[model samples]
Target: MGLFPISVTVVEPGRARTGFRKTAAMRLGSDVGPHGGTPIGGLRAYLANPAAEPPG
Candidate 1:
C-alpha cells in the first residue's frame, strides 16, 4: 500500500472501554465492514457514531 492510503487514528489518553482493537481490526476492503469500498470507511463510520456496533 502507498503512503497516501495510510491513515492514523488517535485515541484519548486514559479513556475507558474505547474499543480500540475493534476499530483497528476493521479492513479497508471492498466487501468488508458496514461502509464498504470507500477508503478508511470503517474509521469514518466509527467517528460518525462511536456507540454504533461494528459489523460482525
Candidate 2:
C-alpha cells in the first residue's frame, strides 16, 4: 500500500481601496508610526500606498 501526500495552501485577499483600510490607518495613527523594519510598519506602508502589495 502507498500513502499519498496532501497539499494545503492558504491565500490572502488582494488590496482594495476600501474605507476599512483608511479607518484602520487612522486608528494606528502616530501612535504606531511605520518603524520601517517590522510587520506593523509593513501594514502602515501598505495602508499608505494605494498600489502597495499585501505582505505575504
Candidate 3:
C-alpha cells in the first residue's frame, strides 16, 4: 500500500481595482473615484469563461 500527500493554496489580490476593494476603500473615506476591476463579472467570470467578451 502507498499514500501520497499534497498541499494546495489559493489567493486573491487586494488594493486592486476590484469592486469589493473599491467598496472597502470608499468605506475608509478614500478617493476610490471611478475605476473598475477586471470588468464584467470579474475574476470569477473570467475563470468560469476565460473566453468571455463584452457585448457590442
Q: Evaluated with TM-score, which candidate comes out highest?
A: 2
What local lDDT score does residue 20 receive in model 1, on the 0 to 100 scale? 63
Residue 2, candidate 2: alpha-carbon lDDT = 39
* Clash count per candidate: 0, 0, 0
Supply the TM-score for candidate 1.
0.26
Q: Per-residue lDDT tens digits of candidate 3, residues 1-56? A: 33867666988754333355445434545322343253533534343442443332
lDDT of each: 0.56, 0.71, 0.42
lDDT of 1 by residue, 1-56 (tens): 88688889997865445566455645332244654656666555555565665554
Q: What C-alpha lDDT does candidate 3 achieve relative to the native structure?
A: 0.42
| lDDT-best of 2 and 3 | 2
Candidate maximizing lDDT: 2
**lDDT (0-100) at residue 28 of candidate 3?**
41
lDDT of 3 at 54: 34
Worst 10-residue stretch by lDDT in candidate 3?
29-38
